[model samples]
Target: MSLKRFLDRADESRRSLLVANRSSPDPILNVLEATFDDQPVRVSERAVPDVETDTVLLVEDGEVLATSPLSALRDTIVTVNSDLYRTGAMGIDDLDMPAVLERLDDVRFTLRGYPKSNTEKLLLVVVSRYIEGIAWQAGHGRHRASFQYLSRIKDERGTRRVYERLAETDVDVHVYGRPDWVPSERFDVTTHVGHDADFRDSWVVLFRPRPPTPDANAPDSPSTDHDPVALLAIETEPHVWEGFWTFDQSLVADLDAYVAREL
Candidate 1:
């Protein structure tokens, strides 16, 4: 569903505020633009309105962040700099918070804190993970479960039973370059099996013999014979490769499949 519809079902309380305004607007008046210590926040020119009237709390990254007035934030501009995108750069491949926050200037975040009296404070988050990539399959069109609960299906590593299945079937399953984002664990992450074209953050799925040609029900669609090729929702950069490792690193793991399955 669209963001608007999602927000409609988000919550009822509109007590908290999320002054989600980004970029530079007009200078502030009474709210002095604090020097270095206290960063200044700006109010937009237009007023925000809500069909339903109620105090709502705002939250982000599983934390109570701010309280917002639904109607006061229509076209209001919020002043911010680096304090915006603070999602710690754990081990992520890309850390484009600055660019993202700048581009998504219109989007707003929820805010919340304590309750006025009886109402219980409600927290809500508006995070998302987009998926738009193709998966590489073995020549036999199947493999064991290797990426079980993988935090990011796109960034697969270490040997898995799936590869063992490919070996048992004697099929070549490989997707070149890094894969697009996929469902992993609970959050989202990048993959190393698919690619667009340029061959930067590409993924690869490699095995013996070439992958079988696609038949009916293939991701590429009615036009069968779609061998293992890069499947991107968008056109990618041009690329070419010579050969890859034929050996599978997960042979030993797959040896005890029956016993493992019992677990």
Candidate 2:
């Protein structure tokens, strides 16, 4: 299946974030609403005591799925910018993402990168790094990521350091993009170069946990509890993209297989 089709396969459910008993300033809530403007998520504030003051609750179908301190949400999401990621100012180890952020998985989104506006693309960038951080922690998964152009790997210091560190691990790291720049010997990744439309217009980051031993009773067998995760985005126009991230094990496995077989 195509990347666009994968995005289309997202579940049709919607989610809401209720800033309950918020003692935070109005600007913080405003930023939260603006960040999710075009997505399927609804952000609102209330004065009810259903939750503690200064906390945000993620609800779907009238059930509270997850909650995080409003201050933590502000620190993790609202007050960030794209430069911290692109400029290598914020490393993967420095990411302390709130649980509410991770709970956004499976929701489809539309964002704009760079020259259009700053806030929209930060969400995707955050999710991309979060997936990378998971792979880094697992240390033995097969990770695949794509940049529209290969030069980004060499040009962005933070991006370069991230791949370098992953290569240092046992993880089989694979990168896809247009061959704008060749990686140095320090980068131990398998490079897949192409000039096709997919190479020029897609952003993907995926991590599939190492396969478990057939014999579960073996002492040396690894745990199979780790689930596969992925993020897929396709540029529909210059600077504008539509995408989604998921933690569904089967879907991640299928997407990983598709990438291995094609593009």
Candidate 3:
């Protein structure tokens, strides 16, 4: 099936954000709502006893899946901009996503960038970097990412640095894009070049960690228990995209398999 089909499949699942015990001002709630505007998520507020003030909860089908401090979310997510990533101002190590945001895995999202709006696309960028950071830390996973055009790898300082670092590690790095620019040998990543629709419209970052060996006993070794992570998006129109990020191992495996066998 196509990448768009995967996004369509993910749309069947839904989640909401509940801002419980919010003692914060209206502006704070407004920002929270604005962050999720036009996305699949519904953000609501209510007062619940025993819950800390300004705590944000991720709820699915009336069950609270995870929670995070509203202040922490505001500082980490709400206040950020796309330039911080484009200019390499924020390193991958600097992205400390809150649990609530991390819990957004499996949620489908539609976002617009640049001339359409400034903030809508920032969330996807953040998630992409977060996945990259995970692969970097794991050190031995397989990372496959797409850039629409190979030139972007060199044009975006942060992105170039990220690939450079990933290449230095044992991670099996693969990059897909249009063949507008060829990467130098120093990058050391397997290049998948194409001029097809998938290369032009898809945005995918997937990391599949190698399973731990039975005799492996290093306490500091990156935990093999970590789930495979993937972010898949397809540009539906100029500057607009629809997609989802997932931590589900089965789905991640399916996605990786598709990429390996097809794209």
Candidate 4:
């Protein structure tokens, strides 16, 4: 469903105020501009003075370093910790506000935090991961039979279990990539040849395989090794989209143009 529908449903239940502590040019504000331009929700530039509202969207840093005081956030504290993108683990220590976490059940909380180095990257990662997580949750519950990935399907370092589980569950997989590379029994696949001809030039070259050296005992070829971390969605939902968009309207316009051309 679209973000407007989500907000419309939430409105039927309780009042919500989009409390944004930071000023303009913030990613959260971009979200408000994109989807809620017509909505009548209140926007605040200060800490929540009261907790009378049913839901609260406290968008700020996780503040794991205690850079700011927690006194302002006296109740129902909900924070997003995205440190896993850098480190291989969740920022559990960031949620160390004992008093706040004690009332975690009292807070209508959701943590869609996984690491991305920058905001632009984080936005795309969030959207992609959110849809995939929905599909995975369905698979676990035996709800939705399958979902399609509109990108290349490669046997990367960490996705073996994902493919295995989907195969075991008989989930219908559709992929838009090299048909020969992926078997038909595994995925309903399509090869997009000569589609977006410049796409290949934009890929970051990380490694290249080489033939064995003349001397059998020669050292292995030089290569780039990256962190083997995978992005995970820890309780993301559709409603969260209502609070995020590109930091600039130009980026949104570019996305619109691309979606018009490709989607």
For residues 1-263, what per-residue lDDT tens digits would candidate 2 score against the true structure? Answer: 46677877666789998899988889999998988887789999888755689988899999988998998778766888877877878888888777777888888888887888667888888888888888888888799999989999888888888888899998899999999898877779999999877788889999998986677677676666667899999999999988888999888888888888888
List clashing residue pairs in candidate 3. none
| Worst window of 10 by summed lDDT in candidate 1 | 124-133
By TM-score, how accurate is candidate 1?
Answer: 0.17
Compose the digit string of candidate 3's lDDT tens values, residues 176-255: 99999888888799999988788889999999998876655655655486569999999999999888899888889988
Tell me the tens digit of each residue's lDDT in model 1 across 52-140. Answer: 33222243443434443332222122232111212211111122122112222113222221332111101110111000001123334
Candidate 3 to native Cα RMSD, angstroms? 2.6
Q: What ranking of all candidate models by TM-score puts the best one first?
A: 2, 3, 4, 1
State how far residue 23 of model 3 sits from its true place (Å): 4.0
Stronger candidate by TM-score (1 vs 4): 4
RMSD value for candidate 4? 18.3
Tally clashing residue pairs in candidate 1.
Answer: 45
lDDT of each: 0.24, 0.86, 0.86, 0.28
Off by more than 4 A, model 2: 214-222
Q: How does candidate 2 fare on TM-score?
A: 0.94
Better of 3 and 4 by lDDT: 3
Candidate 4: where is the Cα deviation over 4 Å?
1-44, 52-117, 140-152, 178-180, 183-263
